[model samples]
Target: MNLTLKIWRQKGPQDKGKMVEYKVTDISEHMSFLEMMDVLNEQLTNKGGEPVAFDHDCREGICGMCSMYINGEAHGPDRGVTTCQLHMRMFKDGDTITIEPFRAKAFPVIKDLVVDRSSFDRIQQAGGFISVNTSGNTQDANAIPIDKHAADEAMDAATCIGCGACVASCKNSSAMLFVGAKVSQYALLPQGQIEATDRVKNMVAQMDLEGFGNCTNTGACEVECPKGISLENIARMNREFFSASIKG
Candidate 1:
Protein backbone atom coordinates (compact mmCIF):
# COMPACT_ATOMS: atom_id res chain seq x y z
CA MET A 1 0.00 0.00 0.00
CA ASN A 2 0.99 3.64 -0.47
CA LEU A 3 0.20 6.50 1.90
CA THR A 4 0.56 10.26 2.13
CA LEU A 5 1.39 11.28 5.66
CA LYS A 6 0.78 14.81 6.90
CA ILE A 7 2.65 14.91 10.18
CA TRP A 8 3.17 17.72 12.67
CA ARG A 9 6.71 19.05 13.10
CA GLN A 10 8.05 21.25 15.86
CA LYS A 11 11.52 21.86 17.24
CA GLY A 12 10.31 22.45 20.80
CA PRO A 13 7.36 23.66 22.85
CA GLN A 14 8.21 27.29 22.05
CA ASP A 15 8.99 26.67 18.42
CA LYS A 16 6.54 27.20 15.57
CA GLY A 17 5.02 23.98 14.22
CA LYS A 18 3.20 22.94 11.06
CA MET A 19 2.04 19.89 9.20
CA VAL A 20 4.60 18.49 6.76
CA GLU A 21 3.63 16.01 4.09
CA TYR A 22 5.51 12.91 2.92
CA LYS A 23 4.76 9.93 0.73
CA VAL A 24 5.34 6.31 1.76
CA THR A 25 5.12 3.59 -0.88
CA ASP A 26 4.93 -0.21 -0.85
CA ILE A 27 3.92 -0.41 2.82
CA SER A 28 2.81 -3.87 3.96
CA GLU A 29 -0.68 -4.10 5.45
CA HIS A 30 0.70 -6.51 8.05
CA MET A 31 3.03 -3.82 9.40
CA SER A 32 2.05 -1.96 12.56
CA PHE A 33 1.50 1.81 12.44
CA LEU A 34 4.81 2.47 14.15
CA GLU A 35 6.54 0.11 11.73
CA MET A 36 5.12 2.08 8.81
CA MET A 37 6.45 5.25 10.45
CA ASP A 38 9.79 3.55 10.79
CA VAL A 39 9.86 2.91 7.03
CA LEU A 40 9.03 6.57 6.41
CA ASN A 41 11.72 7.71 8.79
CA GLU A 42 14.27 5.41 7.16
CA GLN A 43 13.53 6.94 3.77
CA LEU A 44 13.75 10.47 5.18
CA THR A 45 17.04 9.74 6.94
CA ASN A 46 18.48 8.33 3.75
CA LYS A 47 17.48 11.57 1.99
CA GLY A 48 19.35 13.65 4.61
CA GLY A 49 16.08 15.01 6.03
CA GLU A 50 15.29 14.98 9.75
CA PRO A 51 13.09 12.03 10.68
CA VAL A 52 9.78 12.28 12.47
CA ALA A 53 10.05 11.72 16.21
CA PHE A 54 7.40 9.60 17.95
CA ASP A 55 7.31 7.49 21.10
CA HIS A 56 7.05 3.68 21.17
CA ASP A 57 8.04 0.85 23.47
CA CYS A 58 6.77 -2.70 23.76
CA ARG A 59 4.97 -2.35 20.44
CA GLU A 60 2.62 -5.13 21.55
CA GLY A 61 0.47 -2.33 23.08
CA ILE A 62 1.43 -3.01 26.69
CA CYS A 63 3.71 0.00 27.35
CA GLY A 64 1.25 2.81 26.43
CA MET A 65 4.15 4.85 25.02
CA CYS A 66 3.04 4.76 21.38
CA SER A 67 1.08 8.04 21.36
CA MET A 68 -0.22 9.67 18.19
CA TYR A 69 -3.28 11.29 16.67
CA ILE A 70 -3.97 9.65 13.34
CA ASN A 71 -6.43 10.91 10.74
CA GLY A 72 -8.01 13.19 13.37
CA GLU A 73 -8.62 10.24 15.71
CA ALA A 74 -6.83 9.67 18.98
CA HIS A 75 -5.40 6.27 17.96
CA GLY A 76 -6.66 6.10 14.41
CA PRO A 77 -10.17 4.90 13.48
CA ASP A 78 -10.05 1.73 15.55
CA ARG A 79 -11.72 1.42 18.95
CA GLY A 80 -10.00 -0.13 21.99
CA VAL A 81 -6.62 -0.16 20.23
CA THR A 82 -3.41 1.83 20.70
CA THR A 83 -1.21 3.22 17.93
CA CYS A 84 1.37 0.47 18.36
CA GLN A 85 -1.32 -2.13 17.91
CA LEU A 86 -2.90 -0.38 14.93
CA HIS A 87 -2.25 -2.27 11.70
CA MET A 88 -1.58 -0.62 8.35
CA ARG A 89 -4.32 -2.77 6.80
CA MET A 90 -6.88 -0.38 8.30
CA PHE A 91 -5.90 2.16 5.61
CA LYS A 92 -6.34 1.77 1.92
CA ASP A 93 -3.78 2.39 -0.79
CA GLY A 94 -3.17 6.07 -1.69
CA ASP A 95 -4.68 7.20 1.61
CA THR A 96 -3.71 10.56 3.04
CA ILE A 97 -3.04 10.11 6.75
CA THR A 98 -2.74 12.96 9.20
CA ILE A 99 -0.61 12.23 12.24
CA GLU A 100 -0.11 14.49 15.22
CA PRO A 101 1.04 14.23 18.82
CA PHE A 102 -1.41 13.98 21.70
CA ARG A 103 -2.64 17.56 22.09
CA ALA A 104 -3.30 19.05 25.53
CA LYS A 105 -2.07 22.06 27.50
CA ALA A 106 -0.68 19.71 30.11
CA PHE A 107 1.11 17.69 27.38
CA PRO A 108 3.28 20.29 25.68
CA VAL A 109 5.20 19.23 22.58
CA ILE A 110 8.87 18.45 23.01
CA LYS A 111 9.73 18.04 19.33
CA ASP A 112 8.13 16.62 16.21
CA LEU A 113 5.48 14.16 17.42
CA VAL A 114 6.82 13.73 20.95
CA VAL A 115 5.08 15.41 23.92
CA ASP A 116 6.01 15.52 27.58
CA ARG A 117 3.57 13.44 29.64
CA SER A 118 5.20 13.76 33.06
CA SER A 119 2.05 15.53 34.21
CA PHE A 120 0.55 12.03 34.50
CA ASP A 121 3.37 10.95 36.77
CA ARG A 122 2.85 14.05 38.90
CA ILE A 123 -0.85 13.23 39.21
CA GLN A 124 -0.03 9.67 40.22
CA GLN A 125 2.41 10.95 42.79
CA ALA A 126 -0.32 13.14 44.25
CA GLY A 127 -2.18 10.23 45.89
CA GLY A 128 -2.44 7.18 43.57
CA PHE A 129 -0.75 4.85 46.07
CA ILE A 130 -1.32 3.28 49.43
CA SER A 131 1.14 3.86 52.27
CA VAL A 132 1.67 0.32 53.40
CA ASN A 133 4.58 -0.76 55.54
CA THR A 134 7.16 -2.79 53.58
CA SER A 135 9.00 -3.78 56.70
CA GLY A 136 7.91 -7.43 56.65
CA ASN A 137 5.46 -9.97 55.26
CA THR A 138 2.52 -8.90 57.37
CA GLN A 139 -0.56 -10.25 55.57
CA ASP A 140 -1.41 -13.35 53.58
CA ALA A 141 -2.93 -13.20 50.09
CA ASN A 142 -6.41 -14.10 51.37
CA ALA A 143 -6.17 -12.13 54.61
CA ILE A 144 -8.61 -9.61 53.17
CA PRO A 145 -11.59 -11.38 51.65
CA ILE A 146 -12.38 -9.16 48.70
CA ASP A 147 -15.75 -9.67 47.02
CA LYS A 148 -15.45 -11.22 43.57
CA HIS A 149 -17.35 -8.37 41.94
CA ALA A 150 -15.18 -5.68 43.54
CA ALA A 151 -12.01 -7.58 42.74
CA ASP A 152 -12.97 -7.87 39.07
CA GLU A 153 -13.87 -4.21 38.86
CA ALA A 154 -10.63 -3.20 40.53
CA MET A 155 -8.66 -5.29 38.04
CA ASP A 156 -10.51 -3.72 35.14
CA ALA A 157 -9.72 -0.26 36.48
CA ALA A 158 -6.10 -1.23 36.99
CA THR A 159 -5.81 -2.08 33.26
CA CYS A 160 -5.37 1.59 32.39
CA ILE A 161 -1.90 2.13 30.91
CA GLY A 162 -1.84 5.96 31.24
CA CYS A 163 -1.55 6.55 27.48
CA GLY A 164 -3.20 10.02 27.68
CA ALA A 165 -5.56 9.14 24.81
CA CYS A 166 -8.43 10.19 27.08
CA VAL A 167 -7.14 13.76 27.23
CA ALA A 168 -6.39 13.92 23.51
CA SER A 169 -9.85 12.63 22.58
CA CYS A 170 -11.71 14.96 24.95
CA LYS A 171 -12.78 18.37 23.57
CA ASN A 172 -12.09 19.77 27.03
CA SER A 173 -8.77 17.89 27.34
CA SER A 174 -10.08 16.32 30.54
CA ALA A 175 -8.08 13.64 32.36
CA MET A 176 -11.14 12.43 34.19
CA LEU A 177 -11.03 8.91 32.71
CA PHE A 178 -7.41 8.46 33.65
CA VAL A 179 -7.95 9.91 37.11
CA GLY A 180 -11.15 7.96 37.53
CA ALA A 181 -9.41 4.70 36.68
CA LYS A 182 -6.82 5.35 39.35
CA VAL A 183 -9.48 6.28 41.85
CA SER A 184 -11.54 3.20 41.07
CA GLN A 185 -8.56 0.87 41.23
CA TYR A 186 -8.01 1.83 44.82
CA ALA A 187 -11.60 2.50 45.82
CA LEU A 188 -12.54 -1.15 45.20
CA LEU A 189 -9.62 -2.72 47.02
CA PRO A 190 -9.70 -3.26 50.80
CA GLN A 191 -6.06 -2.17 51.13
CA GLY A 192 -6.90 1.06 49.33
CA GLN A 193 -9.83 2.09 51.60
CA ILE A 194 -7.54 3.00 54.46
CA GLU A 195 -6.66 6.32 52.82
CA ALA A 196 -9.49 6.50 50.27
CA THR A 197 -10.81 9.84 51.54
CA ASP A 198 -7.47 11.60 51.40
CA ARG A 199 -6.53 9.82 48.18
CA VAL A 200 -9.51 11.11 46.23
CA LYS A 201 -9.16 14.64 47.61
CA ASN A 202 -5.45 14.94 46.88
CA MET A 203 -5.58 13.35 43.42
CA VAL A 204 -8.55 15.42 42.28
CA ALA A 205 -6.92 18.59 43.67
CA GLN A 206 -3.71 17.79 41.79
CA MET A 207 -5.64 17.03 38.57
CA ASP A 208 -7.25 20.49 38.80
CA LEU A 209 -3.92 22.19 39.44
CA GLU A 210 -2.47 20.53 36.33
CA GLY A 211 -4.94 22.47 34.15
CA PHE A 212 -6.97 19.41 33.08
CA GLY A 213 -10.61 20.15 32.32
CA ASN A 214 -13.65 18.80 34.16
CA CYS A 215 -15.55 15.78 32.83
CA THR A 216 -18.39 16.92 30.55
CA ASN A 217 -19.97 13.46 29.95
CA THR A 218 -19.20 13.67 26.23
CA GLY A 219 -17.99 10.01 26.40
CA ALA A 220 -15.26 10.72 23.86
CA CYS A 221 -12.62 9.67 26.32
CA GLU A 222 -14.24 6.30 26.90
CA VAL A 223 -14.60 5.64 23.19
CA GLU A 224 -11.01 6.55 22.39
CA CYS A 225 -9.43 4.84 25.36
CA PRO A 226 -7.25 1.93 24.13
CA LYS A 227 -8.20 -0.10 27.20
CA GLY A 228 -11.92 0.66 26.90
CA ILE A 229 -11.99 2.12 30.42
CA SER A 230 -15.60 3.07 31.00
CA LEU A 231 -17.13 6.43 31.94
CA GLU A 232 -18.63 4.50 34.85
CA ASN A 233 -15.22 4.92 36.47
CA ILE A 234 -15.71 8.67 36.18
CA ALA A 235 -19.10 8.33 37.84
CA ARG A 236 -17.50 6.30 40.63
CA MET A 237 -14.85 8.99 41.01
CA ASN A 238 -17.44 11.75 41.30
CA ARG A 239 -19.10 9.83 44.08
CA GLU A 240 -15.77 9.19 45.81
CA PHE A 241 -14.77 12.84 45.55
CA PHE A 242 -18.09 14.07 46.92
CA SER A 243 -17.92 11.66 49.82
CA ALA A 244 -14.31 12.56 50.50
CA SER A 245 -15.14 16.27 50.48
CA ILE A 246 -17.97 15.75 52.93
CA LYS A 247 -15.90 13.60 55.26
CA GLY A 248 -13.00 15.98 55.24
Candidate 2:
Protein backbone atom coordinates (compact mmCIF):
# COMPACT_ATOMS: atom_id res chain seq x y z
CA MET A 1 0.00 0.00 0.00
CA ASN A 2 1.08 3.55 -0.61
CA LEU A 3 0.63 5.93 2.33
CA THR A 4 1.13 9.58 3.06
CA LEU A 5 2.27 10.41 6.57
CA LYS A 6 2.14 13.90 8.07
CA ILE A 7 4.37 13.59 11.10
CA TRP A 8 5.34 16.26 13.63
CA ARG A 9 9.03 17.21 13.62
CA GLN A 10 10.83 19.22 16.29
CA LYS A 11 14.59 19.47 16.48
CA GLY A 12 14.70 20.17 20.19
CA PRO A 13 12.60 21.20 23.20
CA GLN A 14 12.67 24.86 22.22
CA ASP A 15 12.30 24.24 18.49
CA LYS A 16 9.12 25.25 16.70
CA GLY A 17 7.56 22.08 15.29
CA LYS A 18 5.32 21.45 12.32
CA MET A 19 3.86 18.58 10.36
CA VAL A 20 6.09 17.33 7.57
CA GLU A 21 4.63 15.19 4.82
CA TYR A 22 6.22 12.06 3.41
CA LYS A 23 5.07 9.06 1.42
CA VAL A 24 5.84 5.35 1.53
CA THR A 25 5.01 2.56 -0.90
CA ASP A 26 4.52 -1.21 -0.71
CA ILE A 27 3.63 -1.25 2.98
CA SER A 28 2.26 -4.57 4.13
CA GLU A 29 -1.03 -4.73 6.02
CA HIS A 30 0.50 -6.98 8.66
CA MET A 31 3.31 -4.53 9.40
CA SER A 32 3.07 -2.88 12.78
CA PHE A 33 2.70 0.92 12.90
CA LEU A 34 6.23 1.26 14.20
CA GLU A 35 7.45 -1.03 11.46
CA MET A 36 5.83 1.26 8.93
CA MET A 37 7.63 4.13 10.64
CA ASP A 38 10.88 2.23 10.29
CA VAL A 39 10.19 2.08 6.61
CA LEU A 40 9.70 5.83 6.52
CA ASN A 41 12.87 6.47 8.46
CA GLU A 42 14.80 4.18 6.14
CA GLN A 43 13.44 6.10 3.19
CA LEU A 44 14.52 9.39 4.78
CA THR A 45 18.00 8.09 5.57
CA ASN A 46 18.51 6.81 2.04
CA LYS A 47 17.67 10.26 0.65
CA GLY A 48 20.20 12.16 2.79
CA GLY A 49 17.49 13.38 5.21
CA GLU A 50 17.30 13.18 8.97
CA PRO A 51 15.18 10.31 10.29
CA VAL A 52 12.04 11.10 12.25
CA ALA A 53 12.65 10.71 15.95
CA PHE A 54 10.09 8.70 17.92
CA ASP A 55 10.20 6.85 21.24
CA HIS A 56 10.10 3.07 21.01
CA ASP A 57 11.86 0.57 23.25
CA CYS A 58 10.03 -2.72 23.41
CA ARG A 59 7.99 -2.91 20.22
CA GLU A 60 6.15 -5.77 21.93
CA GLY A 61 3.80 -3.21 23.56
CA ILE A 62 4.80 -4.02 27.15
CA CYS A 63 7.31 -1.18 27.60
CA GLY A 64 4.74 1.56 26.81
CA MET A 65 7.49 3.57 25.12
CA CYS A 66 5.88 3.64 21.69
CA SER A 67 3.89 6.81 22.24
CA MET A 68 2.16 8.48 19.32
CA TYR A 69 -1.00 10.43 18.55
CA ILE A 70 -2.12 9.01 15.24
CA ASN A 71 -5.00 10.53 13.32
CA GLY A 72 -6.18 12.39 16.46
CA GLU A 73 -6.23 9.22 18.59
CA ALA A 74 -3.73 8.35 21.27
CA HIS A 75 -2.53 5.13 19.59
CA GLY A 76 -4.08 5.45 16.19
CA PRO A 77 -7.60 4.19 15.36
CA ASP A 78 -7.14 0.88 17.17
CA ARG A 79 -8.67 0.11 20.58
CA GLY A 80 -7.07 -1.35 23.69
CA VAL A 81 -3.56 -1.41 22.13
CA THR A 82 -0.44 0.75 22.09
CA THR A 83 1.06 2.27 18.97
CA CYS A 84 3.60 -0.53 18.69
CA GLN A 85 0.76 -3.01 18.46
CA LEU A 86 -1.16 -1.02 15.89
CA HIS A 87 -0.95 -2.40 12.33
CA MET A 88 -1.04 -0.90 8.87
CA ARG A 89 -4.26 -2.79 8.08
CA MET A 90 -6.15 -0.17 10.06
CA PHE A 91 -5.43 2.33 7.28
CA LYS A 92 -6.23 2.22 3.60
CA ASP A 93 -3.72 2.37 0.74
CA GLY A 94 -4.26 6.06 0.05
CA ASP A 95 -4.64 7.13 3.65
CA THR A 96 -2.95 10.19 5.05
CA ILE A 97 -1.87 9.38 8.59
CA THR A 98 -1.31 12.25 10.99
CA ILE A 99 1.16 11.34 13.72
CA GLU A 100 1.95 13.62 16.65
CA PRO A 101 3.12 13.45 20.23
CA PHE A 102 0.76 12.87 23.16
CA ARG A 103 -0.44 16.31 24.22
CA ALA A 104 -0.52 17.34 27.90
CA LYS A 105 0.90 20.22 29.92
CA ALA A 106 3.09 17.89 31.95
CA PHE A 107 4.26 16.05 28.80
CA PRO A 108 6.11 18.68 26.87
CA VAL A 109 7.38 17.77 23.41
CA ILE A 110 11.02 16.70 23.49
CA LYS A 111 11.50 15.96 19.82
CA ASP A 112 9.03 14.77 17.20
CA LEU A 113 6.83 12.14 18.86
CA VAL A 114 8.95 12.00 22.01
CA VAL A 115 7.63 13.86 25.04
CA ASP A 116 8.95 14.28 28.58
CA ARG A 117 7.05 11.74 30.70
CA SER A 118 9.25 11.94 33.81
CA SER A 119 6.29 13.55 35.57
CA PHE A 120 4.78 10.09 35.83
CA ASP A 121 7.93 8.79 37.49
CA ARG A 122 7.76 11.67 39.97
CA ILE A 123 4.14 10.89 40.81
CA GLN A 124 4.98 7.23 41.35
CA GLN A 125 7.95 8.18 43.46
CA ALA A 126 5.73 10.31 45.70
CA GLY A 127 4.08 7.28 47.33
CA GLY A 128 3.22 4.42 44.99
CA PHE A 129 5.20 1.86 46.99
CA ILE A 130 4.58 -0.04 50.21
CA SER A 131 6.81 0.15 53.26
CA VAL A 132 8.16 -3.34 53.71
CA ASN A 133 11.33 -4.88 55.09
CA THR A 134 13.11 -6.48 52.15
CA SER A 135 16.41 -7.51 53.66
CA GLY A 136 17.63 -11.12 54.03
CA ASN A 137 14.65 -11.86 56.29
CA THR A 138 11.69 -12.01 53.92
CA GLN A 139 8.34 -13.54 54.75
CA ASP A 140 6.23 -15.36 52.21
CA ALA A 141 3.79 -12.93 50.58
CA ASN A 142 1.11 -15.66 50.48
CA ALA A 143 1.15 -15.94 54.27
CA ILE A 144 -1.25 -13.02 54.53
CA PRO A 145 -4.57 -14.14 53.10
CA ILE A 146 -6.28 -11.61 50.82
CA ASP A 147 -9.85 -11.54 49.65
CA LYS A 148 -10.15 -13.09 46.19
CA HIS A 149 -12.01 -10.14 44.69
CA ALA A 150 -9.64 -7.57 46.15
CA ALA A 151 -6.66 -9.54 44.95
CA ASP A 152 -8.04 -9.69 41.45
CA GLU A 153 -8.78 -5.96 41.41
CA ALA A 154 -5.36 -5.15 42.75
CA MET A 155 -3.70 -7.27 40.09
CA ASP A 156 -5.79 -5.64 37.42
CA ALA A 157 -4.95 -2.13 38.60
CA ALA A 158 -1.28 -3.02 38.72
CA THR A 159 -1.36 -3.73 34.98
CA CYS A 160 -1.27 -0.03 34.22
CA ILE A 161 1.89 0.67 32.17
CA GLY A 162 2.01 4.43 32.95
CA CYS A 163 1.20 5.21 29.34
CA GLY A 164 0.00 8.81 29.00
CA ALA A 165 -2.98 7.75 26.89
CA CYS A 166 -5.25 8.44 29.82
CA VAL A 167 -3.88 11.94 30.12
CA ALA A 168 -3.73 12.56 26.38
CA SER A 169 -7.25 11.33 25.77
CA CYS A 170 -8.75 13.26 28.66
CA LYS A 171 -10.18 16.67 27.82
CA ASN A 172 -8.56 18.15 30.88
CA SER A 173 -5.47 15.91 30.72
CA SER A 174 -6.19 14.50 34.21
CA ALA A 175 -3.86 11.96 35.84
CA MET A 176 -6.60 10.85 38.24
CA LEU A 177 -7.13 7.55 36.51
CA PHE A 178 -3.42 6.75 36.48
CA VAL A 179 -3.02 7.82 40.12
CA GLY A 180 -6.15 5.93 41.11
CA ALA A 181 -4.89 2.74 39.49
CA LYS A 182 -1.53 3.04 41.24
CA VAL A 183 -3.21 3.72 44.57
CA SER A 184 -5.71 0.89 44.20
CA GLN A 185 -3.06 -1.70 43.43
CA TYR A 186 -1.45 -0.91 46.78
CA ALA A 187 -4.56 -0.04 48.81
CA LEU A 188 -6.29 -3.32 48.04
CA LEU A 189 -3.59 -5.39 49.68
CA PRO A 190 -2.84 -5.61 53.40
CA GLN A 191 0.85 -4.84 52.85
CA GLY A 192 -0.16 -1.40 51.61
CA GLN A 193 -2.45 -0.66 54.53
CA ILE A 194 0.40 0.72 56.64
CA GLU A 195 1.04 3.69 54.33
CA ALA A 196 -2.53 4.02 53.03
CA THR A 197 -3.08 7.47 54.48
CA ASP A 198 0.19 8.99 53.34
CA ARG A 199 0.30 7.15 50.00
CA VAL A 200 -2.88 8.62 48.58
CA LYS A 201 -2.20 12.08 49.97
CA ASN A 202 1.35 12.29 48.62
CA MET A 203 0.59 10.73 45.22
CA VAL A 204 -2.36 13.06 44.62
CA ALA A 205 -0.33 16.04 45.72
CA GLN A 206 2.48 15.06 43.37
CA MET A 207 0.06 14.57 40.48
CA ASP A 208 -1.29 18.07 40.99
CA LEU A 209 2.20 19.49 41.41
CA GLU A 210 3.16 18.05 37.99
CA GLY A 211 0.51 20.29 36.35
CA PHE A 212 -1.97 17.54 35.39
CA GLY A 213 -5.50 18.94 35.08
CA ASN A 214 -8.60 17.86 37.02
CA CYS A 215 -10.60 14.82 36.01
CA THR A 216 -13.21 15.76 33.43
CA ASN A 217 -15.39 12.82 34.58
CA THR A 218 -16.21 12.06 30.95
CA GLY A 219 -14.55 8.59 31.18
CA ALA A 220 -12.28 9.24 28.21
CA CYS A 221 -9.24 8.02 30.14
CA GLU A 222 -10.57 4.50 30.67
CA VAL A 223 -11.62 4.28 27.04
CA GLU A 224 -8.12 5.08 25.87
CA CYS A 225 -6.26 3.06 28.51
CA PRO A 226 -4.55 0.01 26.97
CA LYS A 227 -4.96 -2.06 30.14
CA GLY A 228 -8.71 -1.46 30.50
CA ILE A 229 -8.17 -0.17 34.04
CA SER A 230 -11.65 0.34 35.47
CA LEU A 231 -13.10 3.68 36.52
CA GLU A 232 -13.97 2.02 39.84
CA ASN A 233 -10.33 2.49 40.79
CA ILE A 234 -10.85 6.24 40.65
CA ALA A 235 -13.88 5.97 42.91
CA ARG A 236 -11.90 3.79 45.28
CA MET A 237 -9.06 6.33 45.34
CA ASN A 238 -11.55 9.06 46.16
CA ARG A 239 -12.88 7.03 49.06
CA GLU A 240 -9.36 6.37 50.29
CA PHE A 241 -8.53 10.06 50.09
CA PHE A 242 -11.69 11.05 51.94
CA SER A 243 -11.11 8.44 54.60
CA ALA A 244 -7.54 9.59 55.04
CA SER A 245 -8.66 13.20 55.48
CA ILE A 246 -11.24 12.21 58.08
CA LYS A 247 -8.70 10.19 60.05
CA GLY A 248 -6.29 13.14 60.01
Off by over 4 Å in 1: none
TM-score of each: 0.98, 0.98
Tens digits of per-residue lDDT for model 2, 25-131: 99999999999999999999999999999999988878878889999889888889999999999999899999999999999999988999999999999999987
Q: Which ten residues in a row have the lowest lDDT in candidate 1?
A: 132-141
Query: Which parts of model 2 are misplaced by more than 4 Å?
Result: none
User: lDDT by residue for model 1 over 1-248, one digit each (tens)?
Assistant: 98999999997889999999999999999999999999999999999999999999899888889899999889899888999999999999999999999999999999999989899999999999998777896677588899999999999999999999999999999999999999999999999999999988999999999999877899999999999999999999999999999997
Cα lDDT for residue 14, candidate 1: 95
Candidate lDDT scores, in order, read: 0.94, 0.93
Return model 2's CA RMSD, one decimal: 0.8
